[model samples]
Target: MKKKLKFNRDWCKGCGICVEFCPKNVLELDDELKIYAPRSGDCIFCKMCELRCPDIAIQIIETQEESDEEK
Candidate 1:
């Protein structure tokens, strides 16, 4: 199944933490430094970006019980 990714732009600090940590290269930064999911189809739902985000800006919507607990 395709995993859902949510970015809270207001909460993001444009730190690039999530962009750097994503193993799947699923995230990217724009010219303005805002983070976005560019390779979302490659996402393994590893939750690395969500966990590494200092601003708690990235969220992986639940596709399983484990992900549900995270929210």
Candidate 2:
């Protein structure tokens, strides 16, 4: 499964709760103190960041990658 992390930068307060809750350390703070995921590929879609975000800033977008076998 292919997944992506979406962040509402406007809602983030830089509390880092989501970062702390991330088991994979996929979330990080940028120079602006906003949340970002430099290691998104390591994410396991655990939704910890989404659930722990106090400001409701994080979301997990799950997508099924189409393989040639699907044709």
Candidate 3:
């Protein structure tokens, strides 16, 4: 499975809760102080950031990269 982190920029308040709680350091704050994922490749899909975000701005998207028949 492949995982992607989605952030709702309008909902995010730049609280940095997600960035501070990420165990893998997968999130960061840009110059605008909005949250962004810089080391997304390092994400472990732990969902810590998503849970900690007060604004519910972060979400984890899971996708199948390969066909079931190919598995």
Best candidate per TM-score, number?
3
Write candidate 1's Cα lDDT for 1-71 as tens digits. Answer: 33578888878889998888888887888777877876777888899889989999888875643342211
Instruction: Judge candidate 3 at residue 33 and give its lDDT.
Output: 85
Where is model 3 poorest over a 10-residue stretch in terms of lDDT? Answer: 62-71
Q: What lDDT tens digits, residue by residue, belong to model 3 across residues 1-71?
A: 86778788889899998888888987888888888887877888799998989999888876675421211
Which portions of model 3 show Cα errors greater than 4 Å? 64-71
Computed on alpha carbons, the lDDT of every model, listed in order, comes to 0.77, 0.79, 0.80
TM, every model: 0.79, 0.81, 0.83
Candidate achieving higher lDDT, 1 or 2: 2
Q: What TM-score would candidate 1 get against the native?
A: 0.79
Clashing pairs in 1: none
For model 3, what is the alpha-carbon lDDT of residue 48?
A: 91
Error of model 3, residue 6, in angstroms: 0.6
